[model samples]
Target: MSLASQVGAVATRTFREKLGPEILEVFDKSYKNFTDVQVLSGTHLLNNHDVVVESPTGSGKTLSFVLPLLRILQNSPEIQKNQEIGAIILSPSRELCNQIVSVIKPFGEKLNLSVETVTGGQKVEKNVKMFKNRGVNILVATPGRLFQIIQHEKTLISRCLKSVQLLIIDEADRFNEIQFEDHMREILSCIPKQRRTGLFSATQVKEDDDLVVFGLRNAKQVKCAQERNSAAPSTLKNYFTVCEAEEKTSILLEFIRQKTDKKFLLFFPACNSVRYFQKIFERCLTKRPLFAVHGKCSNSHRAAQIKGFSDSSNGVMISTDVMARGIDISDIDWVIQYDLPKHSSWFVHRAGRTARLNNCHMSRFLDKHEKVKLEEVKVPTHTSLKSEELRQKMIKIQVSDRAILEAGTRAFVSHIESYSKHDCHIICALDDLNICGLANAYALLRLPKMRELTNRKDLDQFERSSIETSEIKYLDPKLEKQRGEIMKEKHEKKVEVLAAKEKKRREKEQRKMKRFGGGRGGRGGNLKKNENLKRKRSEDEDDTENDIRLLKKIKRGKLSKKEIKNVL
Candidate 1:
């Protein structure tokens, strides 16, 4: 199945119109209305120009680069000649690679364009056989897997990459991180210098070195404006509920109950947590069952779980940071960061999963710790988004009207049964990081806890610095007690070893003295042995005294720097 017609042959068509009518028809068929960002970015890519797109998540950023590249490939005579590879697309994970494939594949089949995803999880043998038998027009891949193929499959690399015309790196911020830079650079080095390049990401840092490595020169900077303080989409509603650290799990459960009407994507800290929460959610009467994706899960299992989540109308996709970087799924009503991220910038990507395509923005949920970290996070506001739109959302609450009423009515079940009055109330803690003199306390959180802490009266009782430092201490203790124990144990072992060696040497000396007692072990022989021992002790003491005198002389300026070394 392939289109024999040439695309975008209209007279003096504008850059946006050059996307071709066939693509517009596909967009309409998919119930997707192509946006301004897509048109502008697509036009640049079609003109063999480089672009760095910093659009909000869910703004059709994928197609912005993909469509034009695809259109160019569809019309190229070289592409038609045995479907010689014309474009190479790279993302961080196979899940995203498959998602991008989902969009390009169906439309590609109609255009007779061949797109193949080569990821680390898949078997290279299959890819080798496929590429050997057929030419791939667009090879979407992850860095490591593609590099592996490049090293082993020289024939395939030359066939696909030597003449490649375009390279697209999605989630540019993630790929630019320290972890991916080397491989990204290696991949870049392999590509032709005349290639058109695009780096698309929802979250971007201005000083990222990854951008420079992309070899983007005079690239068009395309961005979609969102009205919010965070780098995430303004449509996203951000909130943090205070509770005991142990209560996080129960709170997440209660949260799911409250949002049963919408879908959810929960982010956990590690693989065990993802599995732990998924198992817990399984026993409950959740509107939809839970699914998990993590490193431990097989590639097929991850793909199945992601597909299950995407295809289902209402369900929870529990996962670790593995799913955080660059994945787009529809109707992810809420993004819950199960734990605070190691880097503040990650919040943008985590929250980006929701409120995609400006669908009423999305909702982001955080606990006390995560919320505090988020407040401390500072990204240089170098975005093209309008400044006026970045008003502070932290000071104000953004929950649904229904949520407010439900809270007042206590519609949801209590997270846990409390038997004791101690540790009763959750507390609101304020943290102000006074970096330079520019520190200002901005975010305020209300913990659902007791009224006061032993007559503290209110939140003002706790100083901001005290609370912030206390949190740091709580999360990461100094380990002073443990360190001292380790040092003491080492010192004792060293002393014991030396004492044993000294005892053994003394015993050996006594044995030698006995062995040297010639011509009958008599009183005279014993007297000689005693004298010898006393003389040896005196000689040792005298040597020690001489060394001490030399040290004193050096301290009293009796020895020069060179003389001191010789004396010691």
Candidate 2:
């Protein structure tokens, strides 16, 4: 048996002996056995020791801390149901917080622990009211919403936090980022110092790390050993395919067609690409259920899409890295990365989406210009080229639908901008991008006005859409008519604003002409006269200073050669 499997067996044995009867019953029904990291981390956590768990994604990091904390809460004599917060889990994103809440709520219910969650998507007033009336024992929250509540409802929430025995910072690596550090600090300060803290991350944390702000007290560091030092689950089969920019969608379509029965999570670097491709896939893959979500989506929209896709037996979810961490979706057959993630850590997190409950596969599309050495990573290559039939279909779709055409251009531009900001610049250099091919891949109607494409010669050779962009109409007649009316109104407003600005400019110029005797030469001559006067005055001042210096030198009976030359 493998080290991981052996560890799991040992963990299962330990859990049955230590965990409460209710939890153990649920555990046996839900999970076969505890994972390697869970076993190592749970031991320290159950002993009331602060822990820092550094494990790969899909290695059951969530349950590693969660189960131990739940047990602690269950066993504690001082804990009161719905009257005090026993434990609090801090997550970076709303989806992640919701996922964490979902996992814990069921277990909390089984254990008679009341679980409550506060995230950005819901109304703050409602959350506040819920906390005040419903109360909570275990609170799962995003840092932003939690911090807001603490800032506003300090007395009530802080009082609840005083009873918090455990604090789990999920995706601790993300909190270490500059954007979230301050919020983490504020949230940490609010929670009682006496509470048990558990810092969990998929990425390996160094002995010397940025997590010092959270201030773990002699924290037991638990890191799970993996095969080949991979940050992704050992069960995940990673693959890559090198293709031109335009060929990406075609290849992705072909791959999806080949695996029609499999559930897919497709990652894009930017939200616009997710939205664009989601629409494209909706039209092309008619039978398959499709959902698109990203950072830009509204709370209700994101929740709906997440729920819709989660309930789907075989569906495709196109999204940004927002869904990368802490989302616990089961039976995901494949993770298709259409674009390289900005950070290497995100790549592992994306792959971790699959292979959670069982072995799964992940495939990434790399532009030919990207020089990442896949051989070194042992990622197998998919050798097939882009399909011409799919390419023709994509072109036809873009040409016919105005919405698709516009979205394609925006997505293409956003991709270029996103690509330029990649952390691995040496491997995915912006200068090396095949702009023409990428534009072709997007089926762009015409090149968008972006600084990246300035003075590019390759675009000359690329075939653009024959139909004028203005002539293109949206597929829905109502939408097309509304768009036309809005465009006309905007144009009229713009013309009026421009005319007003022109009138003001003419009036200002007339005043200037009148002030300077009403001719082009009059303004120029006055400006020249002023310049001469200022120059003459400056020279006179310099000479006067020189005379004073010369007299002073004479008094001292000394003069420099440079001073004498200027005087002469």
Candidate 3:
């Protein structure tokens, strides 16, 4: 069949007119050309058959399923009650959820289909209110938020979704890895068993296929040539420069300056890297806006950055794995990996952001990868503790009073220090309690909790600049454990060095206490003994000098025998 004929423009028009002109308008705006995926997915969903779509990034995957679902919802008015949600779209990240919402909201409004977003980092009570208090014909959500709402308000969401004829899981491959397999299954159980399901993603391994099969019932699969999964886009020019960890940031700065005219999507392994590099860019004193998106940013904040970056003509966005999935931002001139990507799949998705929609150029700056989080599984924390509740609680209690006190001397002292090294804020504060003046012991306490270390004590500039600047990292249990073991020899070597240093320090201090009875670092007994030894040594030296002088005086017969004997 001819490619255009296979694309079936007539099929698109028929759905458009019946659905309304809004559908056709959004379709053209959203996609570059009516690709085969759209044609095939559009036709398949129109046929009321389930579908599993595997297409490359920017291949109109969103619209492929979206357009078809729109057509379905448009024609299913009789089936959907007023205020009943007709379809549910589940994406993995808040950013992706909002992106989907942006894409379909206009079309949805034009068609009188109310669209609402349900994702984490927003108030659950508010989202629950959205479902129960008002009309939401379409719900776009992340797994955790979706699962939470359903778990708590199962009846309400289920009732709203009573007319939910379609369930679309965007980026099924990533969602499958979303640390919510059980929650996903529970969510599936809550939904109508026969709702037409569409699973869309760019990368689907065997495990993904297996999980997808659970939600889909003999769904027809529509995909590009198998090569598309692993292949970079033909238009994309892939280039990489491998440098030592220290040189990565400098090289990145140079690359961004060299490509100043282009826009970019720079990817980091984690959110901290994004924030850390934002600091780097600020230090470089760039004129352009530095857009950032990561798990740490509020949902609205992240969504705003994504939109603002997308609309801006020239800007840099540094993001984490959140953007590495299926986020379509047009006119991205370059996709820079400031750090090594998580894996092969990561390289593909991170690179896919650029060379999109017949191509454009972009620029960015980023840095710092600590060892990947996976290393935490095999090795316990240096403290041999897994949970941070105590650490955080301990931190909280220590800072509680100081965090509250505004004008107190202790607070002033803590502010000067930011007191992170203090074991207990209470003890540090009390020990330093001097009515006369601020206690010198307060030096151990850092005043404000939020103060950042401006200089590196243990690491060099390059090493300290890393996002994983912390001595430790956060790791989840099954989600991370299942990924397989990490090569721990490097970390083991590091631990050994630290352990030896600690041991050596203790032994040296102990010996100081024993030898002199005590040195400045030792007990008072060691200090007193050291003083006595110095006095005795001086006396012996004086006696020897006196005896030599007395001998000289005797040779000259100029000294009394009693004085000489007294000197001896």
Candidate 4:
């Protein structure tokens, strides 16, 4: 039968066996919500050609492509038990891959198909063993670890994955944003082109031609229907605040306190920020259960934290964009952008964490600077910097240290010294001082240096001039001194703050002690009470002995006044 007929047949079977009439109604309503562009693209995907589904977040784009893929997979011929991998889905982040696996696994299991996930931050050997030992027909994995596993055990991956008939890339926009395009392309090269490929993303820009060349060349395009207002859903609210860096912790604590019952996620720009905020939150909200998820966290810790948050009724999750794409937790009431996203796509993904499945709400907090930055930020395109011409250009311009250290090359030398050592590399000659000097000069000029420079050829003259002027500046000692002064001032300020805080803590302890009847000595305190009790005890004992002796003398007086007097 033709692919379309087979898809229809499987879809009918799926509707009858798995989905109820209510679910079908929801699906139909959701399908009708798609724009004409999306409908046409869905038709193309159903017909079994590669396609790129580009739409904004919360446009039902995931279901648009997933349903079609599922229909096709369900209709395809059943593989023998314990066979090779059938379909491979690649996601940009582990959370995303796991989320995709979660979404599809239920349906695959209901259809009696084997589905498994392989993401980074976990034991790769275990996952590989699982895939090999038990059969994994549908494999969901992240790009980096997936490629690493394939490279490490090519035979294992090839044997299990060679038969993959379909490949899906979720969150295709991040491929370029996170600089994973090369890794993704390498994975794509490993898989056969004949396999059905699908790329899906929310917030895809028009300038994404690299995505086209990668796999979306012959693929269909899908756009979501525009809303009445050009705005995102009413559930998503964008808020901006301008505060000093030091006040961020205070603001975060206040926000968390105000939204106690709401399940919130705080997004930070880096792992360090995530950790810092975690400690701050711990100190600020000691009673509330807060969890942090980041790339720096171990797999077990991350998994446990995610699982705990997922299982709990109310908790706060502070994380980087690592939890942006692939994690799915229901009823995430708010998304707080403690730090603005580096890219617009990340902004969308971070917001997408909440308001998933048309539930919950999203709010982004940005500083004034971040808001301005967002206006100019654009999502990167999935393009390769791996061409030979670019490599040659980089190689020609690459510099050596000996040349940079030359007397005339002081500016170049200063620039090189200012930059990270990793950024400067010896491209060509080990011994030629003149070649090194020329390369260093070119580097200082911001011209193509000895390294293989890719894509710099496209820069306009004006842009190149700006780059040259902006990049070739000598390090200013005054500026360095000012920076050091600022750092020292910050340190001194922190010390003062800590000292004040410690004094306050001591005062509070003193107050508590006074209120609780200080030191177990009643009014007199420890040392005074001990001395007073010892003196009183000695006086009491002496008084008692005198009284007893007086009683004895009184008794003896009756016998003889003179004898009593003598005894006294």
Candidate 5:
């Protein structure tokens, strides 16, 4: 009757009896029981019914779909070994796709099912060859990569997909995003309509949403009562503090210093910001290992960094939203949000990274002006450092190196641009941001030229570095030497252009003189032409003077019909 006893009771009825022996064998080692979402979802999917599951983080959403998919594939008689795919799972990001594959792979190995992934940051050719070389019974892919492969190997992949018996779209809410919508539609069209479909997410999907394109036929909607209204798990403790922009980094450093042994995922707004702050945190928090993940990182490098951080018991990862969703990194103690996400819904996703399958905490440092934005979310206020503790330590960072200086400037500019586009514009409005304070927070040597700072009055608070940014030298001698050669080449090109313009001007002048002088036969003839031009000018001047004098005399009553006629 109690919660623990109910879970234990539910445990006996789920996973052990329903799943295949191989799947049950794997689940027995770790999972005591399936979560409510997993239990109900598997029941519906086992009956060959389409399902849309809305559940909270850490609710076993991945396994909810994975269990059914593996069972369906095992029973499917239409699937051909090494020739067709039995199931296709569409995820939003490369990292999430990888996570899905990881969850399914253990069961796959035991059941003799083949699983493979196709996502961006890897060669399309490599992914194409996967279908040719091995039997991919289950394919986990990002929409973009899947669509790309479909375009390149339309004949081959399309043939494999024609035989697909199950379609699972993980994090289905993200598929509605503009970047992935078209790709999802194209992929769905290629999949057969008779197959079972599942849509899963931490957020709720409305009845009239675009995800209906996934072709749910009388799809049973499954909502977990335990965490239906919550985006994060009950174990997550959220604390926030309001501070000036310049004090953000200092406060973050203080937080990290207090918990050096714990792992952290520090969220930034963009890739440039991630790269820039990765360098800063590396120098500042030298004792703690640091990793960076963004869209720009190569597939190998990003995966390697994630593996390194995962292998270590504790470390820091600075990243963009690429690492926000469906990434299962165990033992992460904190999720520090350095900047608000472009969309408020993503706030839940960032905080969801921690408190996953365990107790964890998230601390959000809101800009002073942005404190009001949290009125709806209602995160409790937490203690922050005293005024003295939030001292300006960023100045101690070595920005004399041009690489550091440029990275800081780029990060500042990109952060400003990204801030202006926040979906929660009321709280993260651009007009409220202190450009000068933010630059200081980023440890910028000089304010970057950005539209946000153009013709602004509050910039007086920021002291422009007396050292010219152009004068800063790259730390690498080879790069510095290369830059010098480039500058020299540009200067020489400019000088050549100036000399050519001057030559053109002299030639133009000489041509005009030659045409006039040749018409009058040389120096004497040129002088005669000049005198004739002057005499003609003198006669015209005399005629004008005589007419004026005659008109004046007639006005004085000295009368003359000739004078009146001339005036007329």
Candidate 6:
């Protein structure tokens, strides 16, 4: 039988035997729409076989993986044993991890399974403790923190994973980036080979096969029709305009002001650009609630901003690529590319944020240069090209030296700084050059004519001489010291404030205890000590206020005897 027919048979069996009447009723009641393609793929995954489910944003892909996984867990005797972690899901963004956990929790809970989210923005220790205590059956996390946990507290996490049978990596394409591949490798290494792996992505890149090779060796490919052709569920209209950099802000403002009802997301290339647009938006649209979220914001602040934006459908959220993945907000009518993405992948991901889950109507704005650049590049395919051929092709293409310098200088500096103190400084230097050369070896390697000194000894000697006489100034000591002092003072003040707050809180608790008739020698015996602490706090506050007032007076050149008396 064909895959579809087999999937149909599985679904029929599942409905009759596995789901029963109650679950079917709940599923029917909660689900507005269901796709057969997802059902078939999900059934395949539930059978403990590796499967890749490639569906678009809204075709019920989340439920596709989730429901079958939950059903598998429900049927398994291992779940009854109270396994610490029955399944592991890895997503690219914290928001996505949280979203997956949110979806899994209700289903898992119904089956008496616990679900927990682990991401980088939160405390690692708390998550570690949660895993140790067997509080979670399904653990969803980003790659970085997950690797860190595996590296540092492997025993604690491994127990959970040894019990884990299902591992789903959502947004596989995003996670398989060149920068994060090593971390991804490290994470996959920790998982037991016996466990089943599933890779899910909205847009599958060519690297999916490599991902399969690394872990999911026997993985079955399930390419849903959602990603083929121009069948994107959303009516995402792409448009371009030519304008000077100075006029871009005015145009953006005018465009935002023109929109009356629908909410929008404006994307920028960097955090600085996000802030710049945010300021312009704030000034232009005072009546509307405008919020910006980026990597620069504190974790708590970013979470709050994202939550607020997600909750409200009428407000605009301006952000960088930080919100590109994992952000699930319904009713984002428009997505403006204020700054075009540097890479086609980023552009895809950013655009994916909107037109989510089949809710259509997205509009993208681009400049002429951005349009030209985007047109010149092809969307990344799931095929690898020869490295040398790729290098030659890149050399043939004209890229600005400024772009190369800007990118390479940063990497070069980091490489140099990473190994300056090692005794093998010459080797380190050579390695740095080699690392940098990998980007454009044909162009860069020949520039430094030390290629003839291929012998280790000669290379080392040449490197040492080259580095020793290098004119690069590492860092200004005075500026570094000033920064250190500023940070130290800020930390000291923060500690002092925290201590004061704690003292006040304790004093308040003691007062409550005394007020409830638990006096000295009773439950409130500590009241006197707390009262003394409160007295000291009041005195400190008074002194601080007086000092502030005196400073103001001094600033105004009106310092008087009363200020002096208070200071004394």
What TM-score should be assigned to candidate 3? 0.59
Could you give candidate 6's per-residue lDDT for residues 292-361 as a string of tens digits?
A: 9877688778879988887775788888778776466756876767543444445456666342211011
Q: How far does residue 99 in candidate 4 sit from its true spot (Å)? A: 2.2
TM-score of 4: 0.55
* Candidate 4: stretches off by over 4 Å: 1-42, 56-62, 78-82, 130-134, 205-208, 225-235, 311-314, 353-568
Best by TM-score: 5
Worst lDDT run of 10 residues, candidate 2, spans 355-364
Clashing pairs in 1: 58-357, 235-361, 235-362, 236-362, 425-450, 426-449
Query: Clashes in model 5: which pairs?
Result: none
Best by lDDT: 2
If scored against the real structure, what TM-score would every candidate get?
0.59, 0.76, 0.59, 0.55, 0.80, 0.60
| Better lDDT candidate (2, 3) | 2
Give one digit per residue, the lDDT tens place, for model 1 in 57-117. 6667777787888788877877768667788999888878888998898678778888889
Inter-residue clash pairs, candidate 2? 246-441
Clashing pairs in 6: 58-357, 206-382
Q: What is the C-alpha RMSD, rounded to one decimal, of candidate 4?
A: 26.7
List, residue by residue over 1-568, the lDDT tens digit for candidate 3.
Answer: 1122244567655655554566887766755455667767777778787877776676767777878778788887854457677788988887788778888887887677878888878888999888778677788888788889888888887776667789998887666554768768867877787789888877654454565535677677776532222233434555555333223344455566666678977775555446545644554536777898888798678878888998887788888778888777757887876534434344456666452111011111111221111110111122212122322332333233332212222333333343233323433332232311211111112222323333324212211112121212224355334332342333344345655665675567557547765335765666667777667657755754664464455555454434534543
| Superposed Cα deviation of residue 364, candidate 4 (Å) | 14
User: Over the stretch 1-568, how does candidate 4's per-residue lDDT look in tens digits?
Assistant: 0111112444445333443343344456434433333344456666778777655555445555555556665566555354557778878777666666666655665566677778777677877678568566778888888887777777766666667777777887767644576677667766766777777776553476667546654665655433332233334544444433323334445555666688888876566556644644564567777899888788779889998887766688888777776465656776777543555346566766442211011122222212212212111221123222322332233222122212223333322222212111232112312333333222223433423223434323312223222122224567546655664565455445655665675567556445544466555466665566556657755765664565444533332434433653
Worst 10 residues of 3 by lDDT: 370-379
- Model 1 ranges with Cα > 4 A deviation: 1-16, 154-156, 227-232, 283-288, 311-314, 353-568
lDDT comparing candidate 5 with the true structure: 0.72
lDDT of 1 at 69: 84
Number of clashes in every candidate structure? 6, 1, 19, 16, 0, 2
